[model samples]
Target chain A: MSDFIVGTCLFMCPEKERWMREREGLLHTFEVDEKTKHLKRPKADPSKIVKCFSRPAAGQLMPDTSELRPASVLLSTIRYLFTNVVTRVDYDWVMIYDFVFDRLRAIRQEVVIQRIRGPQSVQILEPIVRFHVYAGQRLCEKNISVFDTKINSQHLLECLKQLLVLYDELEEQSSMCNPNFEENIERLSIGNNRPQMEALYMLLHLGDSSALGRGISLPHKYRGKNVKLAMKISLAWFLKNYVRTLRLIQKLPLLLKFGVLSNLRLLRRDTFQIMSAAYNSKLLTFPGLKLQEILMYRDVEKLSADCKLFNLSFAYENVQFDARKFNKGLLLANPDMYFTVQTLQKYLPIILLQDDDAINDDSSS
Target chain B: MDSYIMQLRRAWLNQDGDVLADLLSLSHNHATNPQLGSDAAMTKAMEHLSAPFDDLVLHHIKVISSLNKDDALTSYAHQSAAIQSLAKILQLQKDENWMLPVMNSMCLDLRRLALKAEASKFGKNQKSGEVLEKCAECLMSCFRVCAADNRNSEDDTKRWGMLALVNQLWKVYFRINKLDLCKPLIRIIESSGLKDQFALAQKITYKFFMGRKAIFDSDYTAADEYLTYAFVRCHKESAKNKRLILTYLVPVKMLLGYMPKKSLLEKYNLLEFWELVEAVKRGNLRSLEEVMNKHEIFFISAGIYLIVEKLKLITYRNLFKKVYLVLNTHQIPVASLLAALEMHGVDDVDMDETECLVANLIYEGKIRGYISHQHKKLVISKQNPFPQLSSLNSN
Candidate 1:
């Protein structure tokens, strides 16, 4: 029944003439029954219909002429409605109602109905249906507000949890249906699905214990097999290492904050770990993932954090940081390390610790 | 002293080098005697020997005789006599080996006399100008002679001496405000294949003069290139010369879309420019007016009043940054932008004027955006509005 509804929503316009002809034939066969006189008809409002066809369908479809046809009309219809009319904040309740009555519960009915028809396989349709249901639920949760103006993060987290569950189930079904299902779908959906997960991760900050653990766990399940999953795992690792690095930098002494030779050993260790994760995820070489800006942002944040630590140490202990000594130490330890530290120091202050007399005496000696 | 003056006048009337040389040499012997070092009569006798001479060797004798006369003659008169003797010695050509040293000292004395004349108000007469012009001509001839001498051209000392002579010629021209007179000499230097052999300091001075000339002629592009090169290559230890370079360089840099940093300006003691820099950044016309009124003499003397006043366009460009941040979107309503402009002291600005400003900014490639006159809106590109300000180091 849900497949029929999906089919109707997708093919409602293109198949309208043939459906009317068939209905006319059936009506002629029934010969004007009293029960049929009270039947309700679906109404179309032009203002409510926004042209929200996905790019593939919109580009392939020819208006006023049927030159090409969609492969899965039902999926196309649901995709259009899901992206356009149903995703609006003003229609959050309507979307929720549709999720509860038409999508979540009714999709199961279609599955059962397909099962009852024969011993035929419903595996191919199961993941697609589950994906639609999860997408609708996530959208409804994102747009819906518990209060007048604010959204509850807890509710969004719950939606994320459900989406994760559905994602796992779909993965299982897809694998059961086809051995290369994940790879094939990943190639086709790389541009579409990754942003959705990233948006979810960003919205939750992925810093909470439950969200971060779930984020890490879901990607681990597809370890080394999926590019998108590897990217997510890499991002999770980057965020984890970034927070740890920030905390470590904050506790560092004013002298070490300059990232001299001894300090750079630890910094290099952390950088290598992050970079290895990025490399393993193929994000280092991935053209679509431009992480250079993000890496630069991390470097800037690390430098600023070091500066803040230096300032804090100065304020509390009355100890000063000498940039020249720090640079000398860097040079003594290794000359190659000076270039990057010098560049980073441009935005930081060159704090003077020793008195002018002391410096003069030292230089003269 | 009276007998010496009589003998010098008789020798001059007789046109006799032997008599003049004898009298000058006798005065030199008495002038160096420690017993008469401060004697008024001895000083008066020395003054008679320091006058400009007609004979080349005799003038040489007189200059050599009065070289140590402290109170004998004014420095201008002494330097004039020395340059005259050097020019005469160069013309005589008795010894080729002495040419380089003679020319070097002549160039040094010419520079001293030119600078002294410039400093004092006593040498603005036609006679003084004619004498300086002759010194310039003599310096040019020495440069040609030294440059033509292949043996001396490769000698670092002689090469540097000749280069110094050229630099002094430029200074004389600058002091006389006849920079045009140095064009032929500069051409000679360029064609002589010695242009690249100039030391860094000499290069800086030459380029600075060229840049100043470009600025006066309103050729800002050439001026910017020359001045920026000079400023960048100037010796870090020479603070006074750096300040002089910045006096003309700051305004040229402003025209080239670079604002001098306040710290840099202050380091050079150009603190008066701080207000202009601030007013241009904030588009504060009133503060700019106040700065102009306070430093009216400075601006006029620096010859940058007009250039500084033209910075109002950049002021407008900066004012647009506030509008960009306030609207917080690519598309800004023209009316709101106009209101912001008016609030920022751009009085009575209307939509057309605002759109024109936007058009000019887009045309200048400062802001990457378009103005939609039909919709009465300014649609700026969010990625890079006002790209010129992005790379600048903010204080």
Candidate 2:
């Protein structure tokens, strides 16, 4: 069955076809008996079928959402979430995130299915992708387990990929449609985010080679300072130059910085392990303040606690780094917050709706 | 036209896959007459042949004639049609992969024609690489049959055709920058346990690509392993191919602290890496920068700039090891390392960043020591402070 789907069309018997149809939720119909003037239902086949489904290869539209709300309602719902609701007094964030992510996903689904290929799609998607990143960071401050941080890196990438695809569509349409004046202006406006999206893609997939290579090749002029810094930090991460990586990441705009910090546990652990090997000394210790600064630890005590978890002993405000004492087998890195709660709340709207808000001002009117 | 039909029929009857492939050649059927492989010609070709072979003959003629008219898109279309027919024919063969030669040639041309078709669409509104991506799908259809031939005996199985298809797919993937897609296809080959059993040429091609992929993933040891296999076992006579392999093999090998011999680099005309080899060995960061900037185009184009950029770590390791050798002390001041970095024209590094540099080296076990922050000293391990990179990777 798997081979047949990807393979060229081939013949199959009706019995097998019927079996497959049964498995694929075979649609049953009522047949009218002319003589009796009554309807009869068809019988089901019990046998399993080893056959392929043949749908002619063509441009496939997304499946329809069974109960879609009107565009205005859906748009307003998202508007409420990112703007008014997110900025309201903080609530059960985990629960709120589920509600918000779902509402935004619905809007995205509606946009794609309805073929809403306009500045509106970018307006909708670009915000959603930003929310994934900033919310991912905000959730990190929750100090949940590493996986539970709601990082959702893959989902974030999916949103970004869709946003990029939309950009391509608009650019292609503008070029082919008329090369008209106003449409050209709108298309050129969307062009502003492409490099940023491209850079954001690399920051998310810091270790992915294709992403890094693509990021490096992006034209220097088009990439904004934050985008370029993100690219640079990605390269630094690539080379295991964590000091350079962390320092430059610190220089990124707050939201992009959060994106890099999401890798904090992994980076910190690897750095600890390396520092243990490099700083193998019983008498000599790395200063705690410097460690906190370079490693982005918000608290000195948590750093010592995490190091102890990794089999390193700390005392007298310095780390007793020894390679032999290091427990190489301990794979999990302790999760902690680098920013205070008040700080995170202060930047919520900006993080979630950076460029997404200005468009709303004029368009909402 | 009548004679061409006779030759194809004869090749079909004789089961001569190579001859059929040759006769199906679309590239060299140049200056075709107006009557050649026309719609009427296609009908005549199909009329002359019978079922199973008729589609094959018609597609071949159509492809050649389309090429004759310089219609790459149409040519690609007919070539794809040719492969679909080839897949049908290949499925019918039992206990032997006699038709693999036809599949191989036709698939090769399919890719070439696809690339040509994509190239001819320059300055258009269409997405670049769209044609090649679709071509990869066409190749996947053929790959599916080859991979799914589980019931066939080894001698006759279509599984042997998978590597060629995968190699073709890799080119498409790499060209389109879709490196991640190579993962699944790799799993199929690895699980099949036919790593070394395929033809030597195909194996070389496979290993070379896998080597480059490993480099991109930053797995230098695996990259070294694969590329060395291709480099040493690869035929020396194929200078062009060996030169190509060396493009990746050189930087990857250097990262593991093994420099290429001058004669070999000269032989391959890859002496650009030689100056790089010297700078890294001497811990001369300034010269390294110069060499890199001079050959920026070559290195970046080869996608080795990043990998070579990694060589800077090893350079630091080398430079610091020198400071250790001259001072010959377990405790070396951070100031000494700073001076060494400055001497080597590493202008941008400061004290904290210097410690970070040593921190990475110590972390990697290239050096066995730690930095004492208050005292501003780097404490070195007495036992093999600078271990050979090759030895470190071995452990």
Candidate 3:
């Protein structure tokens, strides 16, 4: 009996080794063939991968290892399978990624909320936060990805601000329910859990010069000239400064962010560099600055010298800034001030009427 | 005097261009050299120039005005002579057929004079506004004649002439701040089926003037519709005219919550408005004020100062959006909203005034919300806190 067992063990060892090498070969072929095959002729007929996962043989192993693998890991695994295996093999990958990512985010947020504050809070807060995030994602895809820099910046800032507000509300509600909730809530907070996304939000939605200076501290790889140009455009856009926006866009190199090969393709395709080119060629249209003036309407003449300095500081940060130099640059940059001045000159009658309080005060006195 | 009247009648009946031109020149010389003639002699000379001669003299004046060079007479001299002859013709002419042509020629002359006056430092012989008033009177008289003579009113040539005359008259009215005079003309155009008969350019011009008139009158619904119609129908190649239409249409569109495409504005050399659109979209009152001040001349000249100033309400509505974002709740506290308003330069605003402003916005259907005075809060509808300012779908 001992001699037979030794012979069997020796025989099975090579057979097992041969089986292991065959599985490795299969995985390698799967990676290469699956990628090339999917690229060549996409198939939408039900995936064989799905059959493998859904088979009863696979379900037999589930209960035994259920305790070993956490629910979150399993969820992540399923997400990976959907994004990588299922989505990659499918023809409509973009739609699949969008749908799967959106649903996954919602489920993750729901799980987090439920874990932190139970199902009751999920019903109250999940939909609002989900709506904002979904809207923000859609905005990013439609506006930002398409290089609609102006609307993209505005909507991003608004959406991020909304998210921050939701965070505060969640904090307030949880604290109200349990005074000791603060210490326990940190792990469950969406803002805390999604720090990378939060950083992106802060980086994009910066409002002031001070915030801009502080927020733009990304790693070296990401801190490129194209990125800076993008940020500068955003800042000028947020400030409602089209002159500055135009000037910045004009300064952007043709290759901007795309790789050299893609840049060549983009040049041929005329896609990536089209906006700046349009602006340079005077083909882009913008709303009148008069509307901006109305929104920012103030008695600048009434501003004290100190207040002027304060306002200047808000706009620019160079300690050695010369007002005359800046004014000269502004005037030189746009030769059409004549047209702008003429337009304003024509509306002098109505502009005078805008100061109804001053008119009424004079009459009353 | 009977001989002079008979000679003038014979010259007019024969369509004598030279005789009429010489007679106008003589009358103009007499009017200019007041010391040469007594008022009685001038009146006597005018008496010989009867209603029929008025048409003949005006025809001669049109010929003179068209002449590029006259050794002894400057263009201004010719224009003044034309105006003088026009005044005489308008004073004596009673026949509807004669009045219509006289008014048409007068409208053309006055427009030329207004353009000249605008270019010159001093109007010299005539005030542009006064000339514009004369043009308006001529347009009104044309309308009156057309109203009386239905046959002439239906005539395509006469109607086209009237449309062009009224369009020019509207520009004059705008320049002279006599927009109210356009009211009667608008009524006649609409009621008399003139609107249906307008050519494309006439249609664009009519809609533009009516749109502006509506904006001035605070009739935004009508203004939005009319301006959008004008903007859509305006030819793409006529970029300058299109920009002029957009000057008013943009603000109207914004108040109605329809933001114009930035690329569209830039293509038309209207990039100056981009900042304003951004300010209005973001509710940045400070930026709005700054942009307005920077381009004060542009907005004021566009005659959109009042319309843009009214956009402050829309700005306030945008500010409330930030409040909604920050608070992340439908029931926004009055204190927090007031703080937001204060940030936007409403420093002296109290709770009541803030609530009232909110109430006005709500009532205007801009913000779909209600003020809960008892709760010191505004309860915005969950559906759409900021209702879209929907107008006609513009191209």
lDDT by residue for model 3 over B1-395, one digit each (tens)? 34443555676666563554444453333224433233343355366666545444444434343432321224444455555555454444333233344444445655665455444524143333554565466455655544544453354234444576678878888777667677777777788665676678877888889898887776777897898898888888988888888888888888777888989988888988899989888888888888878987677666666567667778887898888998899989988988987887657566755654675566456677565544677778899777666732231
Estimate the Cα RMSD of every predicted model relative to the unseen true structure: 35.3, 11.0, 31.4
lDDT of 2 at B154: 82
Model 2: TM-score, first chain: 0.72
Write one digit per residue (lDDT tens) for candidate 2, span B245-353. Answer: 9999998888898888999899899999899999999999999989988998788888888898889888999999999999999999999999999999999777888
Interface RMSD of 1: 34.7
* DockQ of predicted model 1: 0.00
Give the per-residue lDDT digits (tens) of candidate 2, residues A1-365: 12211211121113444545545554222111233233243334222111222332488653323333334444455666766556766465666665566556656655554566567667667777777886777676464542355446677878888776676566556646564588677677777766657667778777567777766665555477766777778877776777888888766656665666778888888888878877777777788888888888878888998888998888877887898998888765687766665677766676676543122221111
CAPRI-style quality class for the chain A–B interface of candidate 1: incorrect
Highest lDDT, which number? Answer: 2
Q: Top model by TM-score, which number?
A: 2
lDDT of each: 0.47, 0.75, 0.48
**TM-score-superior candidate, 1 or 3:** 3
Task: Give the poorly placed runs of model 1, Cα more than 4 Å off.
Answer: A1-365, B1-85, B91-105, B111-153, B156-162, B217-225, B254-258, B331-341, B346-359, B370-378, B389-395
> In candidate 3, residue A168 scores what lDDT?
40
Q: Per-residue error at A111 for model 2, in Å?
A: 1.9
